[model samples]
Target: MDGPFANRGRRWPNVTVAIIALWTCASPALSQQVSLPPPLASNHATDPPLAEAMQRIEQLEQTVFELQQRQNGGLIEAEAPICFDAPTAELPTHYPIYDSGWTLRPYDAAKTPFELTIGLHNQFRYTGFSRDEATTIDAAGNVNTIPNRNDFDVNRGRLVFSGYALDKDLGFYANIDYSTVASSSIQPLLGWISFRHNDALTLYMGLGKVPGTWEWQQTSRYTMGADRTLATTFFRPSITAGMWGIGKLGDSLSYTVFVGNGLNTLTLRSSDLDTNFVYSALAWWEPLGEFGVGFSDQEHHDNLAIRVGHGLTQTKNDSTSTDQSGAEQTVVRLSDGTRLVEPNALAPGVTVNAFDVWLYTAHLGLKKQGYSFSSEVFMRWLRNIEGTGGTSLESLLDNGFYIQGGAFVIPKKLELFVRGSAVTGDFGTGSEVAAGLNWHLFDKRSARFTLDVTDIRDSPAEQSRTGYVAGESGTLLRAQLWTFF
Candidate 1:
């Protein structure tokens, strides 16, 4: 125990000296050299010990100031010149000025630029048949005549204008169309004014064509076939010569609305025509890549017409002509003969009012890439038709559906497109198959070739005989041209 005590005592002294040495070496502030000006250099300012102590305090204070600056988020100047060529100095911070403008808004077309353009198109078509048949009756009410059907006929031509007006905000368009190949003679197709409010908003109004499911929906303007399923004709007035509006809801959705005099005066009865009250609406949405849904509607008045005819000879005579019912032919015999008549048998004053026809239609289309699937159905009812003898009457109902599939080989520039349209209902009409090819001469002008085989009754299940004609089937071929500047 005595020896252990003696060794401990010796260790304590050495340990104490080691602690003192460590304390001195660890203090950078305390170890700093403190200096004061010499008495002679300082002009005999103060005692040397006093100056040294003051200088030490000053050095410690300077070190504390620097530490505070670093803690207070202060940046220190580099001791050496900074080299911009260094990787650290070249690091990206913010977008360059040139790129900043791009993220704000699209360049305005109205203020930036404008253009003017015009276009024209022409086409001809014809149809041929192997056999023709019609029903006829002779003077005694006995029927035994077959009239020959007329040969094929054709013509379709168009002119259009488009592009910008004023600067960019305004747009102008005009189109003149004529179709001897169509059911009608000549007509002004489209004319309108358009305004661009923003990238997602556009407004168009004035006399113009309405873009619907079948007519203006095709990328190639020319390929559509004639005998446009009866439904197409019924729906045309809703889409043509109307006041229409369209709006886009973001990038995935769009909407359209229109109001017009349904059908037209020439086609509909005078009583059914609406001078200003006509309207339609459509909306479409695409949530997935290539799938879409749409809805539309159109309304018009009823049309009714009547005719009467009685043959006096073997030849067919006009129901409204003098030979059949002229007032001048009236005969009056006094009491002896006991025969008196107020008017002739075929008097023009003897008017006949016939059936009233009413129509309604709707359709849908699903398209993916180059392939498309579409379906349209419509119905018409004819109420009360005066018989051939103005004394009898009949009622008829007509309805049908058109389902089709097609592919676009060249997108909008050119395409070989075809569709199979069918009809069946009150009219006793069979299904039809149609095919065609279309070509674009310019972005807005195109030409088309088409062939359609209709009323095919080869299959007993598909035959619909109405009795008005005697043929089981017929064919129509067409070449058409269309353009919109």
Candidate 2:
């Protein structure tokens, strides 16, 4: 076991030596020079000496204070600099900026002056027709009968690619269809390039849809029903190579003009120099605000919106005849059997002349909350229509009209729609009614399923012994799936 003095020597050695150095010093200057010895062991006989040492230490306390004061300012500074090296780290390489549901963008998209994005739209449809039977009486009191037949087929399959380039100043769209009932091959739908000068003006050129009425210009993918109304189908030009200009005059006004190959012709250049050219123009105005394209009531506007529009298309056809007949004759005829011209019956050489056709259209649209409604009327006139013997055709006029509307029953998820169309002309009078329900599975009309039923009635003059129907009345049912990505 260690004694108390040995414990003190271990625990308080530095303190005891510091006290002894101060006590043995005689003057303030000598106190700085004094050296302290290590602590010593103690015994009972040495208690008197330890007591003397403690008394001497008490007396030298004042001297130790003076010695500290006499020394230079007591300050210590680091002899060298210190530094720290942290571990190296890397930053993320990829970053995203904008996501507008229809476009892809990069981290620096705002700064980028040019970009291109790819997209696709697809629709698969099945249509079924119901048979009908009808009886007709002729002028001689003869009883004639006609019968309709049922038919079903895939209607459309389209793939599209669209994007903006050159800092969005230039835009491009292209599409092709794989479903063809008349021909077993693919078909080109639309391919166009546009140059946008500003928000108010844009120029387009290529094989694309013609600019006519709202129903004609609106994309089929976004229509409320499974298909467009029969009035629009009969009057609207399908596709053509053309140059079109579209622009906004203000927040509430817009206009469009197009000059192209005549009526649904897709030829880049006409083989016949005398072929006709088609010209179309349209102007629209909004009273309460902008009424957008498409028939669905997806916007649910807070205020009532109204749009009114007018459009016109004019064309002149010129065809040459090589017939050797020495009498006036009709060498060219429209698909509807309208004679192009009455040639000089007495002349023995080729003859050529031009005829004119004019189309006029007016439309209106209204929308509020989850309800949308629209209507359009069309009139067509053919000039200089003559029979083979130069006999003038009577009342070479045609007219068509349609009204359509839709309401979202479940906000954006479910919708109900109805449409009716009527046409009157030399080919006879025909009418149709269509009703449908649209179930939006994803984003509005971007992904949807639809069911539609349509009924048609026609006069005897409109009956054709063609592909499907041979009667004056019929019904059709359709189901469709549409999507975009």
In the predicted model 2, the residue pairs found to clash are 327-345, 328-345
* Reference-based TM-score of each model: 0.47, 0.67
**Best-performing candidate as measured by TM-score:** 2
Model 1 lDDT at residue 10:
38
* 153-207 per-residue lDDT for model 2 (tens digits): 4455666666666566788877776663435346777889999998688999988
Q: Where is model 1 poorest over a 10-residue stretch in terms of lDDT?
A: 308-317
Cα-based lDDT for every prediction: 0.39, 0.62
Instruction: Assess candidate 2 and give its TM-score to the true structure.
Output: 0.67
Q: What is the Cα-based TM-score of model 1? A: 0.47
Model 2 misplaced regions, further than 4 Å? 1-114, 134-154, 182-184, 267-269, 272-274, 321-354, 386-395, 459-472
lDDT of 2 at 188: 78
Query: Clash totals for all models, in order?
Result: 7, 2
